[model samples]
Target: MRLQQVLSLVRKAADDYEMIQDNDKIAVGISGGKDSLTLLHALNGLRRFYPKHFELHAVTVDLGFENLNLEEIKALCESLDVEYSVIHTDIAKIVFEERKESNPCSLCAKMRKGALNDAIKQAGYNKVAYAHHKDDVVETMLLSLIFEGRLHTFNPVTHLDRTGLTVIRPLIYMNEADVIGFVNKHQIPVVKSPCPMDGHTKREYIKNLLKQLNYENPGVKERMFTAIQNGNMKGWPVL
Candidate 1:
């Protein structure tokens, strides 16, 4: 997708959800992936014309993996003139070496989020922007139903009372395909995930299932997304 299209969706989400306040400092959680990098660019461009002026801060929580380089991400941030911070952690060693749990995604996510939020809190950022797109929202709801016997997904705006940071997904209206197109069109450098369990998680399984279902029965995914929006799930805005 072009930058204009990306910005249009972003602006809609921010406006509808009241995500950006004047003088707000938002830390974009950069995972060195396409989704996060795309979010980084979209928010960076918003600084130019967004009515409610806000500053952008970019951060990556390094998992202490071997040969994990972030110089490209740093360069991209520099090109966009966004402030970047890299918080180095020993999560890799702890998860794979020490704990060695069969299901590492859950633990890894908790650890990563903890680290990311710590950085955001320390920097006095009141909000953090995640790159969860429409596909992720659907996939998560499916995961919740199939595993936990529940119908649920994250919302566009979530406030963490304890951390004093509100979570916002400005790309909530964006599809995963749009994100892939944006990254390819912009030549965004995405760092390959070096985790040993990259594609061996329940999420990966659900993602593949969604892709197959979409291929066989067109509009199934969209229908599911619509259901979630109207399902009256906690955290969703009244539609």
Candidate 2:
């Protein structure tokens, strides 16, 4: 996907959810992965022509992994003229070495988000942007259904009253395949995930399951996204 195409989808999600307000400061959570980097590019492009005047900042919570290099990410942010910040923490140690949780994704995510949220709040940003896309939405819904016995996924716009920060998903309308296409086409610097359990998780299982289901029954993913849009879920944009 081209930058224009990416911006179109991002603009639609932003407008539909009223995500960007004039003079609002929004931070994009950069995980150094393709999805977040795509989001950074989309939002940066959107800022050029978006009628609503908002600021974009790129933030990453460094999990204190030795092999995690962020120099390229910093250069990318510089090229895009977006301010970037990295919150250093020993989350990897706490979750893996110290706590030794069997299911470390949950605790690691909690710590990562906590660090990200604190940085956003301290920076005085009102909203933060996440990179959860269409595939993630479907996978999360399936995970909820299969495990928690509920048809639930994240909202495009979420208000974290506790933190006084609203979270927005500008890339919610984007597909993961398109994200890959865009990244590959533009040669975006995507840092490989340094986590030991990058693809070995329940979400990965559901992702494969959903892929198989879509293969057996074509367009199932799109239908699932449509259902989510019309499910009357709180914080979801009313279609």
Candidate 3:
């Protein structure tokens, strides 16, 4: 996917969900992965012409891993002229060294989010942009149903009354394949995840399951996404 394609999808989702407001200072959560990097790039470009005139700040929570280098990401943010902030935390040591829990993804994710969100709030950003895509939405719903016994998924836009920080997922209409293509074609700088439990999680299981389901029944992913959009779920945009 090219810049034009990425912006097209992002703009559509933003418009559909009423995500960006005029003069909105949105923080982009950069995990240094393809998805988040793609979101940062898309939104950076979107601000150039989008009527809302939002500003972006890139934030990455440094998990205190040995080999997690964020210099390239910092340079990329500079190139985009987006203000960047890195919150240093001992999450890696806390999770793997101190706790050493067998199931650490949940705790690790929560800790990371807490650090990220706090830093975002400190930076005075009223909104945050996550990089969740179409596949993530469908897989999350599947995971909720199969594990938590609930049919649920994230919304394109969400408001946290407590923190006064609204969340927006502008890449909601994009597929992971398109993200990979965009990364490869544009040579986007992607930092590899240093977490030990990177690919061995319940969400990974759901993701693989969705792949098989798509293989057996072509277009199943689209169908599942449409179902979520039409499920009348609170926070979801009307179909």
Best model number under TM-score: 2
Candidate closest to the true structure, highest lDDT: 2
Residue 2 in candidate 2, Cα distance off native in Å: 0.5
Model 2's C-alpha root-mean-square deviation from the true structure amounts to 0.7
Model 1 CA deviation exceeding 4 Å by range? none
Model 3 residue pairs with clashes: none
Residue by residue across 142-225, what tens digits does model 1's lDDT show?
Answer: 999999998889999999988989999999889999999999998999999999888888999999999999999999999988
Q: lDDT scores for all predictions?
A: 0.93, 0.95, 0.93
Cα TM-score of candidate 3? 0.98
Q: Go through the candidates in order and give the C-alpha RMSD of each one to the true structure.
A: 0.9, 0.7, 0.8
Residues 42-83, candidate 3, lDDT per residue (tens digit)?
A: 999999999988889999989999999999999999999999
Error of 3 at 229 (Å): 0.5
Deviation in Å, model 3, residue 122 alpha carbon? 1.5
* Model 2: colliding residue pairs: none
